[model samples]
Target: MRKPRRGAVILLIVCLFFLPSCEAIDNDFSIWDKLFNPVWDGDFSSLNYKATYPENNVTSGGNMEAWLDIVGWFNMSRINGTDYIYGDPANQSITEYNAIDTLGWNDNMDWIKHELLYDVVNDTLIVQDNITMLWHHSEEKTTSEGHTYIQKTYYYSYLTVYDSEIIPKQYVYDGQNIEALITFYNNSINPKSVIFIPDKLGLYSIDYTYKNESVHEDLMTGYVENNSKGIEFVNFTYNSGWSDPGGNLSHIGVCAVVKGGNFTPDNLSIDIYTPYEQLNITNYNLSTCNLFKGERSMHILLFPILLIIFSPFLLIYFIYKRAGR
Candidate 1:
């Protein structure tokens, strides 16, 4: 009876300790599942672009062109007319004008360039380009109506990337918006093949041979530098230098064609995967959770055992009380 009572107390104490760990394991797995299975269905064009200008009214067709260049959208037309630039998308006419061109000019445009900064922080998967406008000159042009001063603002644009999904497999093109189809060849795991494409232009190539043993910190570092370097610590020493004749091939990931490389003009595909170090860390943590949760589950399963162990003592105690009464 004494042993039974002791066993029951021990089981309950063990279960109490295991419960919190079990709940924590469940929560961690939930978040891991969400993070691993990334979907690219969100928009990638809402990134912010900033530019400064004066208060005078002026034709900003060039500024609009620069902004479009920075955004790197599939722009068929230049700024105002039928003259096409960038990728030739088979007679697809993009005829959207800014607000200043439409409203103040002659009220014949769909979009407008107002004196507002483009904010795209909370926007979903939208890639925004950074724009800088320098007030060069303000000239007074004598038109047929009256003397109107036109503000000359020099616009400079920079391209940055922001994405909603981890691009495990996709096609990215160099100097074009249309991503070319490339395939991934996994040498180790079941001889799997995945098709990838490029999104921007740089030195695009394939690296199917070398498999790193750890999560390539350079990839994350490069991403941070290209997106939000000011808020984060980024080292771009390897990526920012001049390219050799054969082109720099130290990094392994999907990239644009303009950067540099042995671009074959064909599929320009590559195969990349999460490193074993990263996988090991992930699995170790998961295994720890599994063990902890398994102990909790064992405790849950042992509840009847606890009840059985204490049943005789409880029965004796009740009987003793009745006899005393």
Candidate 2:
């Protein structure tokens, strides 16, 4: 075999250096967490807003208009055990208003189910509601069809008193919001093992065990031992029940949080399965330690710097190849 040329040897060395750096680029930055599991500052209180209505009188018999008026009236009125009262001028049972509400209701839904829970130990208040809504659209003059869609939206909200300050918050539309709240104290708890017991007649069960005895805030340090008998692990999401905000867990995943600060997931594993079959577990590992330590932006900037450093080497390799050819 002929000995390799000097240019070839240099090219090989450049590659050895370049490939590792490219791989290290990912490790150097917590790109997964930044993209998927973004760091939440745990300031959910901003989501809290008192229900309000327009000062102008609602005038119309259209379904959308009628439904809005009913909702506005319901908010303005006092709720009295299946009945609503708005200054004597309006007094109606929830059932009476359900008919008009259906006009704008999605999926032919006629009810709004609400659940509320209070945790004395944690000093937390949780409210969950399943509301069916009629999504409306205007008819296009060009198209022959009108547009309307019905949808059921689930909302999860929580309120807590920490350090004598009221912290009220709600989850964003994405599914991760509820999980953030439940595992808000994971880092602080720092449990060696977490066993999620399935509720009686429940849907799923989750268990987590840590391999390394020593805890490293920077590394993912555990394994998920899913020993569920019948319940299949779904997405990490909030319980829809109002009476138990943390109950009826659907999505099972892990989370990390800084006490009195923000919440971010280090890893999330989703298990998909049928009612009576083997489980399929999909894992998502998110690196967020750098984000918390304020190194994220610096790491992102390093990518361009690496390219700049290697650009000359890459150009030389191409030029040498052209001369040899």
User: Over the stretch 33-139, how does candidate 1's per-residue lDDT look in tens digits?
Assistant: 33333322112222222222212222334333322212222221111111222322211111111222212332222332323223323322222333333323344
lDDT of 1 at 36: 36
**Best model per lDDT:** 1
For every model shown, what is its TM-score relative to the native structure? Answer: 0.16, 0.16
Per-residue lDDT of 98 in model 2: 20
* lDDT of residue 189 for candidate 1: 19
Regions of model 2 farther than 4 Å from truth? 1-177, 181-301
Predictions in order: lDDT: 0.28, 0.27
User: Which regions of candidate 1 deviate over 4 angstroms?
Assistant: 1-46, 50-214, 217-220, 223-270, 273-325
Instruction: Report the lDDT tens digits of candidate 2 across residue range 30-101.
Output: 223234332322222222122233222322322322212122211111111121222222221011112123
